[model samples]
Target: MSRTGRFGENLAINGIDGSYGWPVIGHTFDYLSDTYAFGRTMRARYGDVYRCSAFLQNFIVFNSPDGAEFVLKDEASQFSSKLGWEAFLGRLFPHSLPTMDFSEHRHHRRIMQSVFKKQALVGYVPLIDQVVIGNLRTWPTHQAMPAYPAIKALTLDIAAKAFLGLELKQDTHFINQNFIKLNNGLAAIIPWPLPGTALHQALKARSNIFNYFSPLIPQKRRSEGQDIFSRLCQAQDENGADFSDQAILFHLSNVLAAAHDTSTTSLTITLDLLCQHPEWQQRLREQCLRIDPQDITYDNLESLEEIEWVFREALRLFPPAPQLFRRSIKECQFGNHIIPANTQVMVDCGYIHRSEHYWNEPTKFDPERFSPARNEHKAHPYNWFPFGGGSHTCIGLRFAIMTAKIALYHLLRDYSVFATEQARYRILPITKPRNGLPVILTKN
Candidate 1:
């Protein structure tokens, strides 16, 4: 298949660009095998925007910052983020912010905006600190501990407290299990809700979660608390319409997953990097200790600029969300190409972050690349968009960063963290460590 429905003066690149690589499962195996390698190979072969079929659709590849900005910051309203990810994420988080489009996206986002404001962090941080402390205390010292599951558990505890405004001791296991099911639903090959399948389990889990959260909305509305849920309960769009119970459930489910999984992934990777580079760990510890060894406030958190740089670089190397998807809602000009409406497009952040075009040494783990004197990310506006860019950027970006930094802050203060041995990784679903990211811990 070739580019179709060109509008007016612009023209898309011609030819059946890139390898289809097996029908029905076209490019899916290659992509899942190594997303970065596949993306790099495709970009090398077919300039920036090439057409290649995934399992279902032929995605217009945009492995550049310019392409990202074009799709994400669509001023002409020509793209749909909701439609782009509908196949994978829509069933799980239907009415949530990530899947909402255009004016509706804006409206929902505005209502929920208060939950992530600067003032909100003041309340959330203390709760996170307590949770981090409790979670980290469970880690066995001077021995190999699987950091992925540990971090996943820690982040969930933090998410439960910070997002839902509850400790969730009893339901944590159940919630975490359901959350994994929902995430696993993305890789379903059959791609339908059948009996005894991942998608079916996920749908069931989603229903269970909604049932769990059903009774909590009225209390949140009747009272105002510092939790994200409480703020969301009171949130209203410009039309002055409060979120109904159903809307709140959908949003809560979205927020919990968004906060939990990504934080776990990024923080685990950060720990891996820190353990691999002990000097960077020492440097971050020094910066963190400069404020208060155990106590990191919102004001002082800014002072740990070096650790912040490390976190940013970690995000660059392994962004929580490695890809951005958009569907052409109307005819739109992308560079010399005119993308027709109803076309699926993607911006591969994993490729862009590691691309030689933006950074001098893209694969190296040098945190200093993000420094003021050598600000490599500023090479292009969209070059370092881990939380994505433009209007639909992750609403929990602030919360995620703050949570990770604070957690790491306390972690560095208390533990001498290091890798027990080498660990391998794959980028399917998301970037994941093969051996569960085993690390050795010692009391500092």
Candidate 2:
């Protein structure tokens, strides 16, 4: 190894090379327009490990499951999520668990873990059930109604009730708008706080969310409520350093948006698919009717395994967080290329899910792929990890699935929703219909 003027000796300067178009911006716009196409082009050209620019930073993407496990499992201690996500989400989600790394993340995760435990989830179910049925009760029938926007509102309501135990009726319009802006900021072409921009609105919204919840932290402290806010108020790290008021507000706001956005995006995908394939809708509806009327009960929830299969396929087909991001802590080898230290990296799990290498008719929306007989997901463990994998797996994974299942239970049993047209979605911030996918509702 030879020393360079200001760089490391074991350099892979030639190895990390690739042309991603344009000098500074690189393939950033290309990635924004269509992630699958850009990723396919990059993977076809540079194989598993390649170099490209996105959001004004060099992204060394490991576009395979092996690359995913290497960074996601991170047994080698060569990656930092804090630095990796810093550019994309650090503004609104600073100090959040997903943005923290190593011991800090472990400490916070330990305290926050109990919030989604069995005991806590037991209290959350009633709130979720009430919201799902109550919302759908109002949905008009025999007309084309937009599913994504309505689902978005419902998920936000669920977040307010189940996660925070708040009604937020008057603030629903304000709160929902803020989250929309915040999500839009994730893939903004110019992700800066230029006034009137999506990023600016998101920053302002983040401030508003913090301000709104700042006063409630005191109430949650004195309350014995089982909601996430109260649990966070009472939570403590290993050394018993209780999260400060600001920390609680920050973490809660961040996670509330996360739960709201990801769940809304994912459940909307399931709805779109069920609408398109009326046969699956009919099958799942019949399955739902066989279960107890109160199908959200733990036992009954488990019995809706077909709903689970549909959910799995929906997530695989259109993951909310399509790419997993990380930054190398040290020089690391991936495939034939050596990734430079401190380089931002993304593992394209979306591509992996649809990759012909691990899937049969990968593009087809076949829930049977997840059934016990087929178990196509068994082709590879990493091939189907939509909530992500390893240590940083989503904290609310079980809760999210349970919520979606409960919603579907009510929906399918009550009405048969037909797709108004073919559903097409994009993943700029959240996975959602590019034109607001509409469904025609009819009483069953």
Candidate 3:
């Protein structure tokens, strides 16, 4: 399973290559510095596929659509995305679905799929709309507010009510603190188990979340409720096997993180773009006002074809999960190269989404590209994988889109968003807009 193809089998030492100032530790430094820089530098030097040694292991960057296919589809069984992510989230949520694999992975995925059923989503629409409308009332009429916090607040409330059945708005500080600690814990490279460390706080929040849901699951199992956790409590497979209490607890935790973070990120990007394009914002507002505002339903969401384009375009520009990683389970040959077992393969969707070969005027935020005529994404199925693809693709993609659109509909219809002169400057960790996106929210 040695390295094959043009790059050869040697471990990619960071400093030796003329690419970056690898120095003593070489490539490992850049890999940990930041994900964007790491992929950009490697692609700039290695063309499509390049091998480098980092953290004392051989790592490869698959920069092209074909390269991603090699790992994502060609020989997928030989790679594991959960391994690297598990190592990253080990301290805070090591027991969650993202950390399980093989038979255990399949068992959890089956039970989890039940919570996203048609009837379940149908009941969530009104609950989500209520949360969105209530939160928007707090925004100032003309002052610019940070879009990140606004959306983050909105999504958290929606998750609390719709997914976990907890009313968190009145308890904003507790809710926000729990989320901050959870995010900090996930980002800790070295386990944050030390007292007073960010990871420690995150671990405590994790425990609090589990304890909070423990009693809720039993109550939910006895009753038929619309919330996702209620459905998870009663979930069963075709064979009628049910999930245990521990499995339900972990699965519900996965729902909270997945439902909140991605929706917030996507909604922020949507508002950011709407602020930059007032005309589109008006168009969306008109679309929303036409609907019976009081009768917001899942079916009403499909009528929002135009806003859908804006959401897709934003996802293209800044996918919530920008980088994807997988570990080689076995020695495998890809094209002319042979990848050794245990080697980690990384794909930059951020780079691929903006690649000129796949997208026309890739940097421009034009929603028309997603129109039926252009359909830029049709160029390559895997090229526009913001939600990822294949067997392991996001199970909650439909829910993410539906939740985001509802929030955007309420926000855009009532307010016109404008980025401040100092806006657009930010950072990205789990999602871009590292700094909260500051913007003026003028009443429409």
Candidate 4:
């Protein structure tokens, strides 16, 4: 309630403990080099709630479930998702759901909710299976395959058909290339669209995407197709509000990116984990073998309980989006600290996901932790929120789960995946294998 002290000045006096590191650059290099190590070191030094500087900004890192609740729930409306995501995604995905706050976010979310509902999701299973099965068939067996890029391309193909309603023959290569550019821009240090910069190329890609989708909006609106694009075109809220032409483009761009990237990361990690743990992989494969390959539907997808647990463990170990960002709109109390307004707040879900305080053998890749008998994740609501929590929780979470389940079921059923060697990961920005997670897929 008291806005008595500025963020940096008199931090000790204000009871918030943290260091600003070096001037201007702050701890950007340290943080970027290895976010997991940096987070662990910080938490060890300062407990759960601490302040540190990164990427030229000071952030109060909340590395606990309670901190996750306070910032993510934002019960007092004291935080802004729009302001939080602006630094990362504003240039590429302006006015998208992630960049909207409070009532505006709710309004937009309501209109788009129908497209991701149970019925719609059920309709997508066959399409997803088609893409997954078709792509998996093309993967070379008995050799080391780069899983990340291969899966990334497959996810883009899935998105093209299921989300954009595009035919397989369409120019998905252009879409894939542009999306890669846009993703590269998220890590740009400059953040400006200056000539020859990653941001500049990303902005150009954004324009190209807009131009590609803009003319098609009118046709989609009039059509009766069931793909996400058509459903979004016909989406309307209780108040009869609909997405404008530009809103549709923005939502599609953001949704497409989130859909593919997160799913790709999740599938790749699950595959990697399964490869590393042959016992779990065999168990999951046995479960998958029980289901008739022709009958892989939304109804039967839930039967693969071990597969679900494996996916949960994979997300727990390496969340797709490690650190979630939020900016304070007003001074708020997080535990004992009085965080100043306009301060950037990061909920280190990645750190908390692996914290010793929460789980037994936290770093161990044991899927049984999520089994009903153990259920360690149930100890706290926020302990396992990979798709995030609260109002801004990913709308496509169910879709992501379904896609992963289907992809894993088919891949594991046909081929036995083996890790050639231990794979290293790049944690920040997004969790991905540094070496693309090379593995051999031997056909059964």
Error of 3 at 235 (Å): 0.7
Query: For residues 1-444, what per-residue lDDT tens digits would candidate 3 score against the true structure?
Result: 234322232343232233423443446556545655666666777676666644333566677887777676634487776664644555555656666666777787887887776777888899999998989898877786777887888888888888877776577677666766777666554443788876778888878778877977779888767788777888888789888888787777766776677787788888878878888998889988988878789998989888899999999987876666677767777666667666666677878887777789988989989889889888777788888755567888888888877988888878777888434422234564755878888776
Worst 10 residues of 3 by lDDT: 1-10
For model 1, how does the per-residue alpha-carbon lDDT over 178-291 read when each residue is reduced to its tens digit?
888877776666577999888898899898888888888889887767788888888887778999898999998888877788787888888889888899888777776677
TM-score of each: 0.94, 0.95, 0.89, 0.95
Note the clash tally of each candidate. Answer: 0, 0, 7, 0
In model 1, what lDDT does residue 127 have? 87
Q: Which regions of candidate 4 are displaced past 4 Å? A: 1-15, 168-170
Task: Write model 4 residue lDDT over 1-444, tens digit each, in one string.
Answer: 332222222222235787778886778887678877888888999899988876656678899998999999888998888877777887888789989998899999999999999999999999989998889988999889899999998999889878988874467678888887877777677766899998899899989889988999989999878899999999999989899999999999989888888888889899988888898878888999899999988999989988999999999988888888888887788767888877778899889889899989999998999999999999989999998888999999999988889999999898899988777987666667899999999988
* Candidate order, TM-score descending: 4, 2, 1, 3
Over 366-404, each residue of candidate 2 has an lDDT whose tens digit, in order, gives 999999999888766687888877778999999999999
Clash pairs (backbone) in predicted model 2: none
lDDT of each: 0.81, 0.83, 0.73, 0.86
Instruction: Tell me the spans in candidate 3 whose CA falls farther than 4 Å from its real position.
Output: 1-34, 53-58, 74-76, 422-428, 432-435
